[model samples]
Target: MNTTETARRTAVLQSALAKQGIEALVAYGSGPRESAGMLRYLTGYMPANTEAFLVVPAKGRPVVVSADKNRARAFKTRLGDEMKIVKTTDLTGALKEEVASAAPRGGLVAQAGEFDMTTALHAEFRAILEPYEVTDGYGIVTGQRLKRTAYEAEKHRQATAIADKLVAHAMSIAAIPGVTGPDIMAEVEYLGRRLGADQAGCWLAVGERPAETYFDLFELTEAVGPNARVQIGATVCLDGYYSQVLRIGMFAEPSDRMKEVSERLIAMQDAALARMVPGTPIHEIVDALETMIDAYCPYTRLSDPFRFQSTHAMSNSYSDPGAAPFLNAGRDKSRDAESPLVAEHQVYEVHPNFTLPDVGHVCAGDVAVVGGSGATWMSQYPRGIVRLA
Candidate 1:
């Protein structure tokens, strides 16, 4: 929220606008929206359980449209100036009026469809702005967002550290016998919040693959038994920044085969991490991972229902980012980096997993930041599988 950061964000938007030949950009989002990050990244405001739309022109104070009831809160948070608080029923109508009044006639507007614009809104805008040009602004926003600044890197580091501590506590608890999946899950959530994480994406699976997963549950009674495998992943978000950590636990002592498999998977992951230099192309990193997997376990497929690629980088994408290569499997080869591996100031998470049917899956991972020559592990977590009992 410093002046320099504010100016930097505004400058990013302006650069995108200029490159895209846009005079102004209208970014909008509602109801657990994805575009909220883009809006929040540009402006420090984290919207509550309400919809928000920010109109950033090539100049002047940006206009923020929110529910009438949240007007005071919006100002207090300093989301934006020129606030236009409108009734829920009249939200869309109010937005139309606001944009029409402030934006120049026939000026271009870039809209992010991922979260900002709904199907109905898209139709409505297409009809209303027929005379004016509006384009899918995904490219503009994504291109700008692909690289993280120093400030964002620091936020990720803090969030990742929080996850690291939460995982340590959860792992310690999971070591006890007769502990149910839900029990450990609650502890994980609690620890995440206590460590300054405002939000937590806690994924827990017990006894192979559990059909029902409780994200925010506070209790568990089902006890984990011998050979039972539990996979846990927690994405800790601080303020508006996020970083994720994943781990696997077993209630009984690991079998010889299991230990061997885990060691092999860890080795493969280490090889990939070794290649994560600043100038290394992302595809090459993925390729190295696939090569290791194929050499060790050719029978295992790199998809769900089996051992999915675990060694990949981490970013804010809620879905999956930095998935390892399935180069021979005809998967999409085009990731962010095309050729010539990237390095330096880049952050990635190396998670390599191996799945055995009816037995369970094991995920070993750590966040890494690409330095000038190589990569540094950000989260200090055990790299191999851990037995709880």
Candidate 2:
């Protein structure tokens, strides 16, 4: 990523702040891995698991504060002369003090979240600030990120291609009756690491029963056998950009029921994607998906086995983009889907699956983006289940 590109993004963010009458935007927290994301958006320094904050004041220099050790690393990384690295211990207070001293008359301050502010920190901000706004900067930042600049799109394309290679390797060596899920997971990790993946995590399941949701990085399971359904996928990070893949393998021959469900699932996915073109209301697409599900696989009788929702938003690590234009299940409603497409260049991984009451499970998913042409698939993975035996 070019430093000039990052500076342009930061300027856009500052413009957003200016509209809100906020003179400065401060981002700090231990939970957000994208702390570096915020800074890199301002200055091009990708900090790892370390304490850091970005001070985006309306006027003057925008400083990236970090510990002395981290400062050395940031400097070595070549974040440009614009960044001012400082100690991390009193980072929040230090940033607040700088804003206070510089503005002197107290100006508008914006934070990523209310939770990111401690009670004391909130009080201190109020004391030093005239007017303040609690905004989700992630949304503000995501709006800029969703539309991939030519440079960003190219990087993501590389990341997606790497993920495709890893998926292909895993598909080729899929386990049969005696191989465990962990055994397969090991292969995923090896392939990813060898292919320049920053880190890879996978969930492999094989059995007659549908695999339970496995969220951990590494967990072993027993062998997959005939008549069993095996599903595996991973979230891969490459050079700070992210992509994911979800695929299914079968050891047993497909039964009539399996074939029918798989066909319906693919049809549903195609229907969903067909409605994903620009200018089509997002809810309209979501409605069509649910209506098709109900028409094809009545939910009341098959609720447990079948679940489908809007495509998931992509970010550094599945970071929520607030209200971006994409259909998603509502936070409170399990069956409710709410989202709309905002613009072209927004990326998503559409993982739509179908589960039969007793016949096992089948699913298909891949990364795609809304564009002038239409919804485009990122990877050329097979849409239906492939028999391993």
Candidate 3:
């Protein structure tokens, strides 16, 4: 991300903290991948090894505390010059010193986020930052992130464009004889990088039991064969944003049932888009989508009766931990009702997938923004089954 984007995010976060009565956000990152969510949102620093923390006080300049001197040094050279950067073995002491001036009105909070920290680490973190009430208030910041700046919206468009191209490329080669699963994987990865992605990844299931393999996520043991339907999922990361898409690649003529199911999936997504109006409870939409799925789907997945999530929030860190609008809305009616309203500007990946008697896991998915009247597609491609041959 550019300096402007970081500055805008920092300013917005500061305002949000002030509103939530949160003194600061102690976003923790055990490694670079972990850093990609909250920590990187502020410091522009992805920790190489050891732990890193970005402390953002409501009324003060943010600071980055890192145990990794090497990565910290590199961050300074590349991006951390605006914020205070302290390389230290005493991470907690550094954090304490930074937040010392803030009044103890709002609680001090930390974000171990999606991957909650190990018990030992959590105890240590709680112990050293004593005398103040510490809480998991990451939700406050996540709620704020639901609204994206114009910069983020544009980046999201570009990111999804990469994945669209990837799916297209895979389809172009699907009918080629002698093409294997690895061939498509290799081509997609190479093409993704060539298209200027920070990272590109794919999950595929081809051959006879394609649905079963696709259900397994990374299944690619079987080769692409004639008359086989290929179930594929693709993700591409560019800048700090990521995009995802899923589609079925069929080498033979699709059955009438396949076309009908594909159309139903499209209508399902349309129903989902209508629910993305700002301030609507996400759980309401999720419940509605589940009803649609249950009503439309008649058969179990090839391997078993299990089914995957129908939808989720997506953007930074893929399904972002630092963003609200998650599908896992809390269970309690009181809490679940309050579980992340459908805020404007959040991106969600809606992929309703299920298996058929003859076809494997048929899927149609895309990334879209929740704004204006409802969700708008960031993914600009065909939404149904892609006939390759």
Best by lDDT: 3
Determine the backbone clash count of candidate 1. Answer: 16
lDDT of 1 by residue, 1-389 (tens): 44467667777777777776786677765535666666666665554455666666666556666655565365345633333334345666666776776566687877764345668876776665565677767557655555656676676788889888877777777767777767777777788877777676576666654433346555446776666676677778776666777777766677787678778767766777788876566666666776776666535563445554444444444322223232223457564444334646566666665555444555666677777788777787775666664
**Candidate 3: tens digits of C-alpha lDDT, residues 265-365:** 88888888778887887776666676687676675333435467778777666776643334742335555745667766778888887765565566778
| Runs with alpha carbons beyond 4 Å of true place in candidate 1 | 1-3, 31-33, 45-49, 71-89, 114-116, 176-178, 208-221, 251-253, 298-304, 307-313, 319-330, 334-343, 357-359, 387-389
Model 3 has an lDDT value of: 0.71
Q: TM-scores for all candidates?
A: 0.82, 0.81, 0.85
Alpha-carbon runs more than 4 Å astray in model 2: 29-48, 67-78, 114-139, 142-148, 217-219, 300-310, 317-319, 323-326, 331-342
lDDT for each candidate structure: 0.63, 0.61, 0.71
Q: 1 or 3: which has the higher TM-score?
A: 3
Q: Order the candidates by lDDT, highest first.
A: 3, 1, 2
**Reference-based lDDT, residue 8, model 1:** 77
Task: Report the Cα lDDT for candidate 2.
Answer: 0.61
Count backbone overlaps in model 2: 3
Stretches of model 3 off by over 4 angstroms after superposition: 18-23, 31-36, 44-50, 77-80, 89-115, 213-219, 299-304, 321-326, 329-334
Residue 188 of model 3: what lDDT?
A: 88
Worst 10 residues of 2 by lDDT: 317-326
